[model samples]
Target: MTSKTIASSEPSIIESIDQLFLRFIVGKNKIYKEEEYNDGLSEAEQDDKELGLPAAEEKSGWNQRILLEVEKDRVKRVEADKRLKDKRNALLMRYFQQSLLKVVNDKLENSESVISDQLQLRENTVELLKKLLAGEPRYSVLASLLELNPGTRNRLLSLVSSEDFMKALGRDPRNVRDIQTAIGMIGTDVLRFLVPAILFKYRINAYSHHNTLFAKKLWRYEMTLGQTCTALMHDINYRRPYEGMLLSAMVNFAYVASYQQYLSSFEVVRTACLDQAREKGEKNRHDFFYDIKTDSASLQALLVSQADLKLSLALSEKLFQKSFPHLVNALKEEVEGLAYEERTTVGKILFKAVRFAKYDQLRSSRLFKPEWQDDYLADSYIEQDVFKNLLRQELFRFKPTWS
Candidate 1:
């Protein structure tokens, strides 16, 4: 494929209100490999992907080690900038986010990012998983899971067979002699939670390695975000709590996919500019540097593209509407931080809920910024008292047990 080209003139960039928060959400997942999204690709576009690039310049092994290690070591000094801590730390946070994703992208290229070597999904698995989330019957869901992915079947069986899992369910493991018995005891309500929990865990959680720094933290944030959203929605529509969780999952999935696309797009642009510079015998990559991360005209277009999430998620938008009708527009408006009075009921709740989730996450990482925490405009929607009450919850402060 031919390389992607940048516009001759810079495009006008619209800055979103959530820009500060999204900079912290950039962890890796290879949404490009999902297949459904890549249909009808031009041959040239395929070539571009086959040649999809990395941003950092190649260096000698020892030199590279020193470069990366030196950058890693800079965290101390960056964090120590007491006066400029918020801004400088925010920059380092963005670098850290990209570095975490780079680690995942590298592992994916080497075929090492799969959750488990033996785990696999079927061609119709997405459809079936959607049905499963929509509260299909346990027998049908299990049968579909068994027929579609033996890896899932084996794993589910192993989970149900575990002493701790069964003990949590208030069952004696000795009484649950087999998968059939365990499934029988668990009932459909529990199965709905477990089955979707399993798929949802894999579908959107993008950590590629156990040792990676943000692997568990990002996963934990995603879970807590969804849970926090679900709890907030439940306060209003108590009957639709499960649907609320599923909707949050869709948002988180889109969020991750958009980040991946932005990184890929940045690489394509940076590679093209660098290639042209090399042909001209230019030694520096300064031309494209200003257009990407920090200084850019079309900041959203050049960096994280919040616009992409308005498109189809891995699951159907129709499915999301059936559960949460106002949610679709809320995701779009939340990016811009629409005024609370202007937001729909769901939007008002979701916007605050998501911000709260991120606030909780950053606090857990000890990266909380007083600027966001002290914002009067944000507190105006959900008063400071309510925000404090929500943050005081155990789920907001600690990682979920599943994580």
Candidate 2:
């Protein structure tokens, strides 16, 4: 047969079986040779050789490579975690910003509707004061001086004639100059009495266009504070309810000043609260929005530096020194010597009164506790029999006409 023809032909079964046996023997011999070579080493080295582990010298290199891979994975995971946390924080910030913007816009939209109501309440308060003071001859004279309405002036004049007015003034006027002097003296006293009310009225007008609800609420709060302070002062035999009134009225003067500058005061307060929260850590996080202690401290500072009340100058200075030592050096030149106990007593009562008013407002509005708890006036101090009785009486008598 030709060679091509012979190759094309199939092999016999015996020939194929022989070829398969030859391939199997060759593979088995190679494995036997490796086993025979491993037999020369000790049991541990044989196991190591079987497992294909590196020698000690090369072990470090292998470990380093493994560590490099692990480190790489750790870094990737850490970066991913950081990205996730940043995304979460950004979303939270956006939500808070939207919420704040909505609140601001709502306040603006509803301002006009509420302004007339606030004005009506203010007018009602003024009328109530007029009625309360009508019986006093001095007040009648003061009313005549301040009254712009012709009919009201005539009515007040009729109630107090020139003779009665002069007697009340404790002056026997012989000439126009004497009469003018008597009128001026009475006017000064009237102005002193009217200062709180005047401030209240001015704030109502000034803030109506800016934040009507806040203006009304602030006026109410001041009134409540003034009344409470007056009662507390009388109970403690402080003998100066008017001074208490002035002090309480001036508590939010800084806020008013801030309003004048387009709510810069709120920003200052907000920043201060945030700074305090960061310093105090998570436990005091709520303080970032409404810290009562900070409010009291700021108010005390303003009273010392800006309230301009001679009677309170010494007391305010002492309060500032005790409550805010950091400010002492800057204010030392302005501080006057005063009794520490007296200043402390005044500060406690003032702080409690403001806190109570804030709390009462929150409660009346049916607001949540956390929203106002930072400004909470602890009942621990104000719940005593003396304070409790006085607050109860004042609250009962308190009539917020504008609500």
Candidate 3:
């Protein structure tokens, strides 16, 4: 009875349901149309136009607002990517530092004592002599004569007893004192040849037995450079091939020693990297391993001095003095006052040889070749065709002996 006359603003139940459905449809259509309109305008323009702004103002505001937001988002994304890259690089550097420290610490802990060091030195010398004498009939005969036989009274007696030994030494046993004197003289002369060969072999062994990857890389580089240098000197008819060989071998050995010293200062290196990152920014941080500033002259001096001393101790004083009378003096003069031209020549040859060897190693090992940037060697040296053929010959002969 209360609803007998329906008000204009109110409706019956069925009419109310139909009105609700119609409103729902109308709302959905309006939303769809608004979406279509919004698709044609920028977000800023859509909002401004919906709020009843003029078309010109909407267009102008749209460009500025949208561009600002896009620029802000782009900046944020770039910063995020940079942070991610820096974090990854830092982690990688930390891992390398840790690994290097472990290697250096292990080497230090297991370093041999003085007596053991002497024994190892003697053993290396003996092994080098054996290798030097292994394949040659004449050298083998001389080596046999040099060996002490308990069956005989001494080395002299052993040599006198053997016909081949005396023959190789170009001595007659008819005069025992003369034979002894001749053997002494021959031994002294032979030592000149033997010493350099022995030192070279020792260097090769030292490089081969290194426990680290970087050491191993240095070893390969040394081998390639030494061989190439020696061959180049020979090809150029250099009067001092032995000097060239000794110098090349010493350069690499000294570098390795210096690098080891650097590695021993791993804590300093890590701190330096951190400081560099903080001060110069992460992108400008120094690569500690590759960026080590080795004093070439100092390294050369140290190596040459040690070599002179060691060779004197290892060989008979008379033999060493007679054979290498000016070795120390010559080395001192060359290393101390090395001319720019001379340094450039040697450095260039070595650089080219090392580069070639690196590429060869990479190709042979099926490893990825990184972009070969100009490193320390390149900084100090320029490539030339001075020893191109010689380098090729040496590389051809110098097969990879490393695992």
Return the top candidate by lDDT: 1
Point out where model 2 deviates above 4 Å.
1-194, 204-207, 263-343, 368-380, 394-403
**Model 3 misplaced stretches (Cα beyond 4 Å):** 1-142, 145-210, 239-244, 253-322, 325-334, 341-383, 394-403
Candidate 1 per-residue C-alpha lDDT over 1-403 given as tens digits, one digit per residue, 9 for 90 to 100: 0011256353211122244334433322222222322222453345434543222454444455444677655644544553264465446446534544444334323221221221123335545555655555567555655556554555567776678876777765544334545566665555544554555565443454321333354456656666666566655764444444555655655444433433344555555555766778755333433343421122233224433444333233434555445666666566445666788766676666666666676566444545545553344356776666566665533221221
Models ranked on lDDT: 1, 2, 3
Model 1 residue pairs with clashes: 1-44, 1-47, 13-298
Q: Write the per-residue lDDT of candidate 2 for residues 216-262, one digit (tens) a residue.
A: 55566666766676666666776444444455534544344333322
- Provide the overall lDDT of each model, using Cα atoms, as 2-decimal numbers: 0.48, 0.42, 0.40
lDDT of 1 at 32: 26
Clashing pairs in 2: none
Worst 10 residues of 3 by lDDT: 21-30
RMSD of 2: 35.2
- Model 1 worst lDDT window (10 residues): 110-119
